[model samples]
Target: MRCRGLSTLAAVLLLAGGVPARAAGPLLVNGNGDPLVWGVNPIPFNPDRGTLGTLDNAAAVQAVLDDFGVWAAVPTANISFTNAGALPVDVTVANYLSYLGVCGDGLSPIIFDTDGSITDDAFGPGASNDILGFASPECGSFVPPQIAEGVAVLNGKWIDGVDSPSNPEIPLADFKGVFVHEFGHYVNLDHSQINLVEGFDDDPSNDDAVATMFPFLATGTSTPHLDDQVAVSTLYPAASFASGFGTITGTIFRADGVTPFQGAYVIARQVGDPRLTAVGYASGARYFPSNTGGPPAPALRGLYEIPGLPAGSYTVEIEPVSHFFTDGSSVGPLDPPAALPGLPEFYNGANEAGTNPPDDPTQSVSLVVTAGATLGGINVVINGFPPAADDCSAATVISTVPFTAGFDASAATSVASDPLQSCTFGGPNQNGHSAWFTFTAPADMTLRADTTGSGYDTVLTADTGSCGALTEIACNDDSSGLQSSLTFALGAGQTVVLEVASYNAGASDVLLFHLAPVLP
Candidate 1:
């Protein structure tokens, strides 16, 4: 039977004021007493299982799960339909919770029905409790199921009518992809780990092809990307809960040849079977771009310190700020260096390094940070232009120039270039560029920028993207006009680009970009 009144809980909570402030401690998991769960059978027109609909059945679900190496027996239930028109939010929410293992009298499962009210279709307790549900009509809007606090809600309409002519069934693989994503939320996976992708490595330009949990929704081909598996296994390891693993500490700095980068994210992931990769706080942490917490290292001037790591070998990544341009104009206050020909109307020009494109790492080094030992000398350097001639005017000209051809990160003479262009930029001139780099994404990232030339109007900007259109994420154009920095999200395979240019034309020798990855 379709449940009523349950769908309104989410609205009531919103009306009563959203999530209450949470005090610091280990993040709470599945603490909610009233858990909601949802269920669906693929018989849209037929009320009996004999005429079961065309959508993927339990066998299909099991096959997809097997692809990810997760084995579970599908449960059978005699789900009765009351010709209730549509499922209710209460039922959807309850079902959603049950799928994630989040119901009971302290653990009893709470079931609700979707009465098909478009407005009241979806239900949830917001980011705090991590439980929610929605009707089939609403489910069409989101590809994957979502969760909060161990809840599993489904769109019964979509599930039943998955094979409808107007709305054909989504691929079984895609269905599994959605389930995996929603289950991620049940365990508190934040929208991709922002800091880890943005600020930790040298090149913040390349996209992470292996990140399963990247923010993009599934299209029915369910397969966990490397990052996705890393995230899930890390937060909810196979082993039972235990405490007191040793910690590892280290700093990530710019390469020896370039200026120190700040506010970049640094991440460390175990190298081995995807299922065994370390995650959460154990995967890696972040340090801010400004290094406000402390001083740079003696050898590496812009050093970042990361702490609390389980002992293991890890891949490291660094990225710039995570922002994108939308309207083809300026992103924040930073102006374009020069409008390129035939540019799009709305573009993102925040991350336009002469050499290093967003997601492109200037350096990559393998090191082991012991469970309790502090490691040092992990320096990443960007190539800088050599000194100009002695003439004062020449010096001014050289200093004011935004970038030197010699310093481009793509100019690396040592390594073979990947056929894929690393970074890109957006702004008035479509000249905005992107770079690609590979690194381990820790839990957080920081970004920082500096201006070396005498120009008074230089500014810094940044953006982020997974596989689709880039979005404006963050930017900083300090009124002082010399330096700026910020920290933001980083998804695996996600690219972050930074743009350094004059606020106004006529200013030259104006910009410098520095990235540093801090671990905690």
Candidate 2:
């Protein structure tokens, strides 16, 4: 069923699919250019015979159907949905696995984990806050071998349901929101951390967030938004898909005009509509070399293409990839800076803090995209100098309340070799530069230091006192992924020193830290 007469952008975006026929940007992720869909299968659910009304078979089934309807209503997509009733589970593997008939029947099942036993066990009991509901990808083109489908598990034990589909009205975990988020993955849609909380505490449960596909299920997940709609539509485009959208492609460069700049993020925001944001990365992966002919050395390069944008005027903005990207927002490969290579700037260096170039991307001289047309040559040159604001040595440790520091540089600003501890406080064996910091642990708590996604290989060190008589409390190479991590036991009210240095003279990278009460 196709929407032969799609109307306004709102009509096309919000109401299009909800009706019988219709239409679709943010980013239409890198799927193999193939139509990745789950077909119109009965979205089955196993209530686990729970007493909660929300978990009852009928209500649970309807909930899944309603949410599926919300997505199927998209007029421009060929994706369809139907209820498969409850999955037959007379006897099977583990309780959760039983609900997920991957072993018995080849179908995706949504499990309502009534007892904490299954959900907690799957996530390792104590470590579930970082998770709520999850979609299992059995197949697809995934980086961590993802963007596929297998099974979905919802922590029914914790979900306090809010009946209305138009909900998640508060910050509490809403059932509808979780289903929508998981379904997005069921359709091969990945997470978009576009709604990153302004500062170091990269929480994404923003009530005002625009995408249902955000990494952390935000309040906005109850309903689809511009970002979600465009991405889904692009993947499963319907009839007449090309008549309503266009594409924007370009390259990101350093001042030298020859070096490719990788990891920089790009977006085409619709003029006057702050919510209409289309994101793309100036990436070296799956793209060509820079315009000046030099490769994005040290694995740094930038090239982008944003497709499925409604024909309209848009401001193309370029900015530095904030450290929060690795803190939790960004998925797949780590994108932390190896060096604070440059400050964020607009395309063509317009409206630079000091310069008043009339053609700043944010102004009237914006890029105009025509339906089905590809707009190229929208190149941007990032300011190559590292700003002091981004330098670790130039930072002030505010409190021991837990924070983050990034060292996207070549060498440690300064380091020490302590004789007081078995291992010297010496950091990173690699020509890897470093960043410095200090914090006062207000109370007795465990300190967790990490370099999960710092671009280059990493080595982190923690000490107290002066450089001459340092206490090498913690030091590590690799514990998580290609990054480094360390869990330090510290008492409250103690002053602790921290270091973020790369392993083996690595490239610009990022680091993360956390503090919590020692678990009994």
The number of the candidate with the highest lDDT is: 2
- Local distance difference test, each candidate: 0.29, 0.48
Alpha-carbon TM-score of each model against the true structure? 0.36, 0.60
What's the residue-level lDDT of 500 in candidate 1?
A: 42
- Per-residue lDDT over 1-520 for candidate 1, one digit per residue giving the tens place of the 0 to 100 score: 0111111112111101112111000111111211111223211210111111243334333432343233111111122111222212223333443322322212211122222222133332232111122111111101122121123232223334444433223343444544454333333332233223221233214223223233333232144443444334333333311121222333332333344443333344555631224332211122111222223234232343333445666545433322221111111111122111110111112322223443133334445545546555443333234222212112122111111121222221111211121122223322212222212233343433333322344344455543233344655545343544544455544445444433332233323343434221
RMSD of each candidate? Answer: 16.9, 11.1
Candidate 2 regions exceeding 4 Å error are 1-35, 39-54, 90-93, 98-104, 139-150, 160-173, 198-206, 251-264, 275-303, 318-345, 349-365, 379-520
For model 2, how does the per-residue alpha-carbon lDDT over 1-520 read when each residue is reduced to its tens digit? 0000110011001111111111112211222212234433433433233422246656666677777677777665666665544556522226555444244354456666543345457546532333556663333332222222345555544444542322112233345776776666556565553433211122333354445665554444567766666666766777655667787777766655567665555667777664545543334332222212223244333566666678788767665443433322343122343232454455643433322333333343377888878898676665544321223344446462334333235433433342222222263242335555667765565666665545666566777776455577887766766666677766766766655554444555334333322222
